[model samples]
Target: MNNEKVTVTLELNKDEARALAQFVKRTSHSDCEDKATSQNEAYLMMDGVNAVMKSLAEEGISPR
Candidate 1:
């Protein structure tokens, strides 16, 4: 068995990026039946989004 990781490149326009960010932000703030689990997942998702956006910004590929 092998465990490995791969990198993916996503090409999104400014509007699409903005929309995705907004969606992630909203998800991070939303509630559900499984509050703890759902919120954890949302926060993790938000963190991933932030990390990617930060990396892109560092590379001068920001939406703004």
Candidate 2:
């Protein structure tokens, strides 16, 4: 596994940011593992979130 920094910038309101932060915290806490597993889980979550955003966009909901 490669240890690198990937930056993601989202334009979200305070509520959205808080919600996302809570979601991430909950997911991360659900498992106890090393840093690699934690990072992989985070990536998987971001991927899922991106897919949802794309689907929403296709349904005419602008992601931005």
Candidate 3:
């Protein structure tokens, strides 16, 4: 990974922020690490969340 970092900003309402925080709280780590392979689960999760945010933005919809 590169030694670069970013600070993203979002203007979410209290309810929306709380909901996202709750979702993150409920997320569980997967045990996909066997002796031979290690999975990049965080990347998978980030991709999914990014896709959802992009879709909502394209549709001009707010997540409930």
- TM-scores for all predictions: 0.45, 0.42, 0.48
Q: lDDT value for candidate 3?
A: 0.52
The positional error of residue 14 in candidate 2, measured at the CA in angstroms, is 20
Better of 1 and 2 by TM-score: 1
Best by lDDT: 1
Give lDDT tens digits, candidate 2, residues 1-64. Answer: 5556576555766567555554544444234233336766766656655654554454444423
Against the reference, the lDDT scores of all candidates come to: 0.58, 0.52, 0.52
> Pairs clashing in candidate 2?
none
What TM-score number comes out for model 2? 0.42
Show where candidate 1 strays beyond 4 Å: 1-37
Q: Estimate the Cα RMSD of every predicted model relative to the unseen true structure.
A: 5.1, 10.4, 9.4
Tens-digit lDDT track for model 3 on 1-64?
5536555656777677656655644444442223213357555555555655554455455454
- Tens-digit lDDT track of model 1 for 1-64: 2335557788888777676655544444343323546766666556566766675665555553
- Report the number of clashing residue pairs per model: 0, 0, 0
